[model samples]
Structure formats: structure tokens, C-alpha cells
Target: MSGAVTSVFGIEPGDHAYLRYAGDDERRLLRAAHVTAAAGRGERAVFVDAGAWGGHDPRALPGGGQVFVLTPGEAGFAGGRLDVPRLMRVLDAQADEAARLGLRGLRVCVDLDEVLAVTPETAPRGDGGGPGRCPLAVLRGRSRPPAVICHGDRARLPEAILPALAERHPLTLDAATALTRHPLLCVRPVRDPAGLCLEGEIDDSNLGLLARALETAPLDGRDLRLYVRRLRFADVGAVRLLAHAADAMPDGHRLVLHAPGPVIKAVLRHYGWDRRLVLEEGDRG
Candidate 1:
């Protein structure tokens, strides 16, 4: 709501780097700001390099010197290929999220043949680069080359993992976006001593709800039991909600996010909850 940019990196929200923290118009504006900021810093260029699964965003900023994204290719039938509708949805989510990060106007580049500029280009004849092929990642900035050479250890990746990327990519990306916009989101579950159970929606809509639940728990006294089954379905919004909730937690109360995170735990991991939200016995406080 405040769209405060939290830090110099603008990595956090309290810094006021964003506007709505979760909207298109606001995201676009903020993204533009980031782009401008990056440019101001004297950075040569910015890139939206796609991952192996071929991440898609609704729009890629065209004004920048150059911008691109990775998409599925027939390289080896890794994930077969996603249909247009599916690709668009993924693209849209990515585009929206990117905008929030201040990289609006991005465009999708379908390169399955590994035709783009990959890092460690030309392979290490003997420098610091690898001798074999290079790996793929969300590369950005400097000169903004056209994906020099697609490289990454795709051998271990299950062929189907590529196809299934769509199934989980959106959720993963959304969770990440939300966390960036609201790093304050974190949790500490308090269980019920009489009956080990925690009831609440792990979604962003109810961050406040989760906070309320945590507030009523007696975490400092006993080990609290928590069920994150309810948190499996949430977006960046929830992260902010969580951030808001965590910022209000009482000292000494512990929260436990009970294993196997819903979305990629890495998405929320960066915020680094660090006992900030303690998980203990049920809400018996």
C-alpha cells in the first residue's frame, strides 16, 4: 500500500522503490524507474535471459538497448513444448513481475537451439570459464548481447522437468515477486497443546489472519505445532502480508514453517525469516 523503497538496492519495499507493491501500472512505473536507475548508474545494458524451462513474461521493455527471454525449443524434446495460451499466461505473469522490478517492455525470444549468448562464452581455453558448455541463468546487464551461447548442465534435468516447468514456474515466479515487494513477510506457527493443529489460509489475503493467529498462541512456553498445508497457495501479495505480520510479532515467540515449502522455499528464503516469526504450541496465549 505504501510502496516504500526499503533499501539502496531497492531489494526491499520500505525503501519506496515500488508504488502499489502488486499491480501492473504501478509495476510498470517502478520497473521504468529501476531501468532508469540502472542506466543512471552507467550500466551499459540489461538482459532478461530466460531459464531452461523457457520463462515467459507478458511484455519485454523494447526501449532498452536490448531485452530477451528464454523459451522451449526442440533442442532435445526436453519439455516437448508449451502451447501458446500456456506460454502467454506464464509470459504475462513474468512480464508483470518484471515490471514491478523495473524492467517493463520486455519481449519473448523463442530460442530452443541455444542460439543466444550464454555466459563463459567461447568456453575457457584456460581462463576462469568452464572447458565444456556454459550454464543458463537469468543473466542481465552490460553490453546486452544476444545470448552468446546457451549453456547449463541440463543433462541431469529430467526431460519432463522442462515440460513441467510451466506447472510450477508461475507459482514460483509469483512467490518471488511478492517477496521482493514485501520482504517483511515471515511466519512462526504456534500450535494448540490440547490438539496439535493450526488452522489458517497461507495465502496473502490472510497474512493479517495468520498474524492474528500467531498473536493468540503461547509460543514461548511450549513447542507449537503448525500446518503449512494452508500456505501452499499464495502469491507475492502474501509475502507482503507476511512481512507486515512478522514486523508486528512479539519478541520470544517462535514460528516454525513446517517443511517442504509450498512454493520454492528459495523464493521466501531470501527474506530470511531467521526466528523472526517463531513457531510454537497452538494459539493458547
Candidate 2:
């Protein structure tokens, strides 16, 4: 529910949150949070591939949000659904930590058991080597789903999430969605006449729109341009937008990108978009 303030995530015992994708990969809503927060908390990086259902390598991410199944000797439960009882155990363990971190209440959660049992290996999250027990440990946070159940009391579970729980794979949103819904800073350019101008930073809040623009929208063979006053060392949000922008562009479209500083230039160089996207002269007027 949009009215809900806090957030919570639930995952299977094997699925963990942090995962390290190659530099240019997108679709990292679940794992990216741990990574950015670790450095802020004076911690190192630890990647966990909570999405890997089949036999595949794990992604690098921060540590924590780890657990194991209750019955190792039991046969499988369902195709996609996790053993709800087992998941509740994992969530209960993390509940104290969640409380300490000052996380919002149950906003979102992911059922890793469903992700592994129901979804085929072909599913994006599942690294389909075979119909095997998911290697990736489960992880739960406040943002999206794939959350740990935290408790076995189904009756005690929030009534709001009942519908989500019924479905095999619940709808999982991300930070970008949160930002799009609620923004800290407003950055909209109003074009009336005379001189044209721009406003706002390529900040995390609006990065959701940028990603949506690139992933879902169609921009083929048309000319696309990003006019910025200046650029700086970008975050996962900014970098992801850039990558999505590049990937989502229509082949016929030529990119006309402009930046005002070397910080942005460094990022451009890192992603090697200079070749793919045409750089415009720095014009900060």
C-alpha cells in the first residue's frame, strides 16, 4: 500500500541480498542497497547472490541477511513457493537487526522459495543450470520483496500483504520507484520562451524515471541527448541510468551528451560511452 511508511523484505534461507554484477550490469535493485550502505558504515564489500536458483556463480555484495533451511533432508515443497515456515525462522533472526537499523515496517518483501521453486532456470533471477536447490541465500530488506518471512505466524502477518503472499512471485519495486513516488529535491525545467534552461541533479531520487525511460521506453534510431551543467563521480543510480539510456536507445538515434565537469567525464570514460554516445561541447550557460 502506498500509504504504508516503513518497508520490510523476506527471502528464503539460501538467498542473501548483496550481489556483485559486472560493472555495466543493470537490474540491481535488491543488492545495490547493501553495497552503498557498507562504505557509509565503514565496512567493506561482500556480495551475495540471492537470485541464483540454479548452479551458477554468485554476485559480489555486502555480507549479512544469511540463513539456512530447517529441513535439509526434506523433499522439495512447491515449484516456486518457498516453505513459508522455514522463511519465518530466517526473518525472526533478522528482526532485531532490522529494528536496530531503524528500517521502516513491511513495505516490501521477496519470497526466495518461490523464486527458486516456481520460476524456471530461464527466469532472469534463476541461473538455470537445473532444477536444483537454490544456492543463493535469501535476503530481506525494506525496499523490494524477496524478503525473509521473519515469523511463522501467518495469522499475525500483515493483512495488507496477504494478496502478495498468495502470488508465487510478488510485485517487487525498488528505490527508483520510491524516489519517483516521493522526491527529496525538485528538479524540473520549465520552458516558457527566450532562453532554454535545465534544473536538478542526476540524483538517486529521479534515477527511477531514467531507468524506466531506458528499459521500457522505445528510443530507436532517434537522436537522444542529455544536457547537463556539470558532471561528477556518479553513483550506482546515475551509472545505471546511463547504462539503461544506452541500452534503451533506438539504433538510429545518435546520442548528444553534454557535461560541465571532469567528474562526469571520468564516468563517461569508465563506461566507455564516449564511443557509443556522441559528446557535446561543455556549455554551462
Candidate 3:
């Protein structure tokens, strides 16, 4: 891994960005940006070339740090069958090794266009399985999460999967402008009683992001109060996730939904979900 820091896809350490490039020039520019950002942060970088290498030289990258390259076949993958778990394990091990080597951190880049071409329609869920299984869901909220950039050829990637992929990432990069922005879904942790403050829309596409956030919340067996007053809308999937969280609460503990909007409340009532979870009307706790 190289210890060079430069900015690519407008991404920094502790952030994840998705980049959709148009051509080889754009791809190389973004790759250089990633290497530059990692080098500037004094971190090593790992580039996973999912078949887009095309004789590119890693040494030619601007970063002075070590750059580790992993081709698709060398990463224990063949065709559409993706061993996501094994891939994650390898990345985790690499991060540990980087830390041991006294590097500040690690940056990871994946060629999404190539990965998707070989990613089976029914890929292994690999720990993120449930009602809505997201294969790359495990990449979120790691203990020492590296700056991840999933690059793709916009014209070649499937349109249907774009929203799903974007929701899994907190930040996105516009290849044309190299700008980054966050999606609507936001999960903020409340400290006192250890609850969640959710805002924005929640539906099938991003429901797992909410579930992942709830799973990691520091409820500590206490009543889990969800402040969703700022939430604009939610679908049946969001309701299901909330109900699951409510059911997991211990005896004497409750799952409370504070200040849910009229539409949300009506949906909960219509499906009799209000009976399963507590619904508070106003600011009163």
C-alpha cells in the first residue's frame, strides 16, 4: 500500500463516495484523485481492478505510498459468483495490517462496472440478509472504516441498481463535476437515553440503511425512542423495520415513535402497527 494523499471523487478519509465516469480519461483522473487524497492523508491505498486494468501502471500513480492491486480472479472470484464475505475479510485484514505497519489509514477503490458485470443476480447475502438483502451493506459503519470509492462507467452500469447502490453510500460523487453530496436519509444518535433521531424519506431502496443504523444504536436494553418528527415519508418496509426493533426490546422496555406525522400515523393505524409500537403525539415523552 502506498502512503500518498490526494483527492479523488471529492472523497476524504472516513467518507465513502460513488463515482460514475464516462471514459478512460475520466477513470484515470478519478483514480489519480483517490491516490492523491490517500497520499495527502498519509494513508495507503488498495485498488481492486475488476477487469478494467488494461495495462495501467500502479507505480505511475502520483501517490508516494505503496499501492496494492487485486485483480478480479486473484480475489477468489470467478464469473458472477461473488464471495462478498471473503472479500470483506480480506479488506479487514488489510486494514489491520496497515495499522500494524503504522500507516494513518487505508483507502479502497473498486471498479463497480466490472464487479457488477460479474456479480450474480442472486449474489450471496453475506451477513446483510433479511427482508431486503443488500450485498454491500457490510461496508457501512466499520470500526475503522476506510474511505471507499466505487467507480463505474455510467453508460454501462444498469440503471435499476443505481439507486440501491447510492442509498448504501452516505456520499456520492458526480464524475462530470467531481462534487460530492449526501443522500436524504440521515440517522443521528441521541446520547442521553441512547435513541435515534431519523430524518428524511425511508422506503424499500434505503430501508436497510435504517435497519443497520438501528442495529448499531446504543439502546442498552432501555426503551428505544425514535424521533421521526422530521421524517417526510416511510413505506411498508420502514414500518416493518420499526416493528422488528420493537419486538426485540426486552421486558419493561418499550419502542417509542415520537411525533410521527399524520400520514405515518395513519399508515401505522391502518395496519394496526400502532398497537405493536408506541406512538407519541407531541413533544411529551
Candidate 4:
């Protein structure tokens, strides 16, 4: 149980893992994983909820670990806006309480679905500026708890803000796809190159997810590049999907794949799709 949380969620103690969930089902899965992991590690778990828990009450977890559900109002929200600083204070206090109770560590899952609904322009930021700039950054620096900053209901949060928020954390996982202990595939939007960054494996199980990513990606008439250097394995079905997406693009607009593996290239070449999809052998760096 020493590395229970890390083994399950790929999140180490005192590290912040960002989760972008599509809906409540994914959120529930992640929440359940966190609860089980924290209990295994004998750590007190605090769920800071802002309408993401669906009105679930806090209860005692297994192995003598306790769970606390915190609301925005309980964290001291003065005005109409959700004060991020106050939220940090609340989280710190919870950590202190966990320590006083002789718990091994603290684990927090913050559901920011309601928070993002109100502030859709950008992610919530704190007052101070520096290494520990944003509220979540400060939380990471202080408590060092294995924190899951859940950006729930992906439709509510703007895609433009995902990159900036993701950069602040060590790991960014999509709840819709990252169901296992270790992530199978991670699809993230690239801003400058105007493409999608695909990491990990893409198989039949996650082919539909990849299709949705390509369809929803910001697509202009220009080339829709896919940064696949970190993508280790992609099955034939996934390769075919990419080729079809590239073929569907407007004239002179193709899907550029950077550092595609042998499997992808062989599949495309065998199916006569290598011509339609632009494959770059060299690294994009």
C-alpha cells in the first residue's frame, strides 16, 4: 500500500494530477479509485465539491481513514464569485486536521465543474505571482498531498484554457479514457501548431475516442497536424481512422503525423493510405 495511489492513478504523494472529465460517470470512476487508493494508504481523503459530487455525503472510508466533503460555501465564499484563495485555505485546514488525527497523509479531489461554469474565460488563478502562482500551484507547494484537480464537465470549461492548466500539473488525464491504473491513451490539444498531441497507446477500445478528438479538434482548411512522437502503439483500426480523417479534409489539407511508428506507416502503406496522410520521419523538435 506504500504506492497504492501512484500505482492506481499514476499520481505520487504531494503531486497534482489534472483530470478533465467528460461527464459524471467518468468522474465517479475517478472518485472511487481515489477513495480506494487513499484508504489503502491510510490517508484521510477530502473531496472539495462544487456541485460535482451530485449531493453525496462524506463518510468513513476503510482502514480507519475518514472522508470529508467540502462545499464552496463552507470554504467561505463572500461574493457571487468563487474565491480561490479561500478555497486553498480550506484545503490547508483540512490537511492540518488530517495530520492532527495521525493519518499517514492527505488526499484531496477538487471538483471544479461548478467553478468553471461561472468562470469560463480562464482557469481560476490566485493573487500572488511567482513559482507558486495559481491557487492550485500553491496547494501543490504546501500540503504536497496527492491532489486531483478535476476539471469536470469538459463542455463547460473552454478548450483554450486546457493547455495552460495542464502545464501547471505534472500529469493530465482524460477521465473518459484513463480508466485503468495506468493510462492507455492521452489526447491533448496543441495550440501553436494547431493540432492534437497523442501520448500512450491507441487501440480498438479507444478508437472512437480518437475519432471524436479528430472531429472536435480545431480544424481549419489548413493541415491538421498530429504530434505522435510520444504515441508508442496504434493498432490498424486506429491507423485506418486517421487515414480516413485525413482523406476527408479539404483539398490541399492533410493530416500531418510527426514521428509515426512502424505499425502506423506499414498499415497506411499496405492500405495505400500513406499517400493521403503526411508522415514525418524526423522529430518535430
Candidate 5:
């Protein structure tokens, strides 16, 4: 599976890929080809069509993949409103079925902008009102999960939702940069408590990337918790950035560092960041 390129954005597993397209028929076919290639590599590809199969060719889809055409007022909706929970349940069932079939994992390609646009009232609340409650939030909370690609039309999606969307998704791509490759660093948003998770290694090479990720994090005046359990290494600069994030938190709110090992803990204490940040050991749970 390591040899297979499971994501259209070339991102690693357990990361969300955001793709911005111009909403043309050609672009739709290109997107289908990406998903089809993933399905050919033993991954169960599921594409949720917000366009309801208009101008798309099912014959182009690879074998052993599923495509759902979601109509706004379809029977799956409640009172003409798209049922977010029910939609999620259907995806969950697909994941289960994929596991039973002994496939690598499920790969979901969805156009959430269309979904949200149709159901304006069901738009996800971003003020930290509830943890792991929103559909997107619930999807991010899953551990050891599938590869997901979220599609959005550049002209159609509202500007207000892009920041929140980018925060949840690590790799953002557009039609022009869709095929470009990126460095390997897994930075994902935590769902239950609503924070950020850092995996893989952080070093001088990717410091700028890390800074941009931190800047775009949806802190929103709430306590920002960073889970670094899977983080293998952090240079001094990275540690300083973490300290700065803590210091930059709003008054009365704190930045919590979760599960930093002895080495990272010692570095933080040595730099006197122990006074600036709240450090916690053990599992994030």
C-alpha cells in the first residue's frame, strides 16, 4: 500500500485533501479519474456527487467503486433538508463494508460546499459550541481512517467558510496545483475537543510550513490544545513557535500541549516555556 498513491492531492493517509475546481465537465472527469486510480490500487473509492450526475460519465469510473448522486430534496433528506447525520452514517457503513472486504481502506471524495449550500441552516458552527458534533468534525475525529478529498468550487463556496475548511484539511490544492507534490508532515485538526494534532517530524526544513499551519489554526479564542503524541522530533525553533502560540492565546484562555515525551518536555523546561505553556503528559484522552 505504501507504493500506491491513494490520494489525488498526493497526501498521506488520515489527511483531508481540499481541491478547488472551476466546476466544468472536464474537471469533473479528471476528478473521477483520480478516484478511479485510487480504487484500482485496492482502496474503496466513494464519490459523493453534489452535481447529481449531470455531465458525468459513469462508464469512466473504475470497477469496485461506489458513487452516490445526492439531490438536495431527495428522499434521504428530512423536511427537504439534507440530513447530515444520516449522510455520515452512510459513509460509515461504506467504511465498514470496505474493512469487511479486506480492502486497504475507504477513499471518500465529496463536494461539501454543494451540500452546505443546499442546507444553509445545517452549516457547521465554528464557535466551539460543541465537540465532535458537526459532520466534518466527526469525520476528522476518526483514527486510522480513510483517505478523503473534499471538493469545492472556487466561485461558489463562500469566502467565510474557507478558513474553517482549510483548518480541518491539511493540504489545500486548486486546479493549477492539484498535481504538485508536497513535503511529508501530518498536521490534522482534532475534533472532539477541537484543536490541532501534529504527527511525523518537524525540523528546520519545514518550519515555514509549520508556521503557516499554526497561523491558520482555528483557535477562535478557545483553549488551543496541540496533540504531539506521534510527533517524533521538534527542533528548537519549532519549540519556540509552540511557546509563542501559548503566549499569543487570549487572556484567561490557555494553550495545552499534550503528550510531549521526555526529550521535548526537557527542551520546553530548559527554554523556560514551562512557565508560558500548560504541558500535560500521558494520552490525550
Candidate 6:
């Protein structure tokens, strides 16, 4: 990871950003980074994850910021269905608590997939139809509302309501995409495909870092795939390094490259490195 601090998606207070992660590990990684960044900025962070189902304890960081986790029951889910208004009020109260705690700002990261799995398809009566009554209304309070990041895993999302889900958010983004340029590369573990996610650019500067990460990556006899849909650039040296990594895999367990961009594809083809790694057209998720 780069030492440079940067926004993963340019998310700001009062902005409701939608994120689609490749798997649970990726979601957890991003969630931790988001919460830590918020705390570093002296903002109270509220995170909603599956672990909260087992009752997560609130944590206080050294930066004078605290984290609160909302449990499943606390989220206003009665009889396996979500109470949107109740959840909204709970979030508002959390923000008020943050204010009282002397936190400068608020940040909330919700595992939307886990919470919405039990949510009803139809909207609750008068929940979102009127002014200041919508579930997201809590995010646009009179004072500063918390910066909100809602995460979903497409594999776990209900196909019946996926379209409606996307329609609700204005700025939807893939978790693989990198919003900053300085990092040059960001690697995340993916569980569904049992591989690694490569974001941003990969060149001579970070080729060694990539090599080291690959060396430490788990390869349990299955082919390791690299998700590179958001990889912006890759030099010939990087291609060569990947080729070597693929060559080193156990027999019948090739390194798979998912959604390589035109630049990487062209480089692989030009140098005949594509023969070393299995190339897939799209992300499995």
C-alpha cells in the first residue's frame, strides 16, 4: 500500500455513494480503510457489518474519534423485515451523539447486502414519499450529515430488485476502480474467484511490490485469477513479471487474468505473455 493518503471514491459528507464489491473480503477491507480514514480526520465513524450481528463493541481510536456498530436488532429489523423509518431515526440519533461527543464530522459505512437481504421489496407506507421522510433523508440533515458508503455484492443481491437498487443512488462505483492516481497500484483479495484484485496502474515503480504480494498470496492448488478491470496501465515489465508468476504456478493451475484493459492486452499479445496466463473477458461477479 502507498503511504500517500487519498480518497478511494471522492466521497464527501452528504454524498450517498454506492459501491459494488467483488466479495466479502474486499468489502471488509474497504470498510476498515474508510472507518480508519474517517477517524484519522477526527470524525466519528459508524460501521454496519455482519459481525455486528454477533454484537460488536464500540471502539475508541487514538485520534479522539470513536466507532459505533449497529447490531441487526438495533437496525430496526422486526420479523426479518427492515423498518426504514426506524433505521433512519437510529442513524440520526447516532449523528447527534457524535456531535455531542465533540467529533467534527460523521462517517457511516453500511453493508447493504447483509441488511437488505431481509428487506421487503415494496416500500413501507410513507417511508420515502414525503420531504425529510426518506431513509436517506438522515444523510441530508439540517447540519452536516454523515458521509455514507453503501456496499453490495452482486452475487448476493436479489436480482428481483437490483435495478431499483441502482436507481436509488446517483453515484454508483465498482470497488475495483481507484479514484486516486498516486498509489499507482492497489491490490485487494477476492474470495469468490479466489484471486487478487489489481487496481490503478502497474509499472516499473511498483512491479516489485506486485511481485512480493503475489509471492505471499495463497494458492491452494486452484488457479489464481487476477481481477484487472480497473487496472489503468501496465508496462511491459509488469507483463513480464505476471508472466513469470503464472509460469511458477503448479501444473493445471494457471494464473487467470480477468478483464485486462486494451493496453495490457496489447502488451501481453505483443510480447506473447498471454500464452502464460489464462485471459478471461469479464469479471466472474
Number of the top TM-score candidate: 4
RMSD of 6: 15.9
lDDT of 2 at 187: 29
Kindly list the per-residue Cα lDDT of model 6 for residues 1-285, writing each as its tens digit.
112223443455666766777765676667666755554334567776655322334553344447777765686744435576777788778877876876656677776666543233542112333212225435665465677777777777766655555566655777666333354689988775477888866656788889988987755358877888876555557778899999998778888888876556655775677899888986442
Per-model TM-score, in order, reads: 0.31, 0.30, 0.50, 0.51, 0.47, 0.50
Error of 2 at 132 (Å): 65
Per-residue accuracy of model 5 over 117-180 as CA lDDT, tens digit each:
4223333333223212224434565765666677777667666656556555566666555543
**Backbone clashes in model 5, listed as residue pairs:** none
Per residue, candidate 2 scores C-alpha lDDT tens digits across 1-285 of 111221111111122322112221222443444334322221222221233423333322223422222222121234444454554454444444443443311212233333443333322222224443232323333233232221111233344443333332332333333213222323233222111122333455566655544443322236545554522223434654565566656667665455534334444564465566666664442
Residue 161 error, candidate 4, Å: 2.7
* Candidate 1 residue-wise lDDT at 140: 24
Better of 2 and 4 by TM-score: 4
Candidate 4 per-residue lDDT over residues 1-285, each given as its tens digit: 111233334453556677777776776787786766555344667776665455544543344446777765775443334566777678777777777776545677766545433332435444322222235544666635445555555776667666666665666777755566445779988776678888866666788889999988875348888888766556557777898898899887888887776446655775688988888766652
Candidate 4, residue 233: the lDDT equals: 54
- Candidate 5 residues lying further than 4 Å off, grouped into runs, are 1-9, 52-62, 66-85, 100-102, 118-134, 160-164, 180-285
Write down the TM-score for model 3. 0.50
| Model 2 residue 169 distance off true place after TM-score fit, in angstroms | 53
lDDT of each: 0.33, 0.35, 0.63, 0.63, 0.59, 0.64
Better-scoring candidate (lDDT), 5 or 6: 6
Superposed by TM-score, candidate 6 places the C-alpha of residue 14 at a distance from the truth, in angstroms, of 0.8
Better of 2 and 6 by lDDT: 6
Positional deviation of 76 in candidate 1, in angstroms? 11
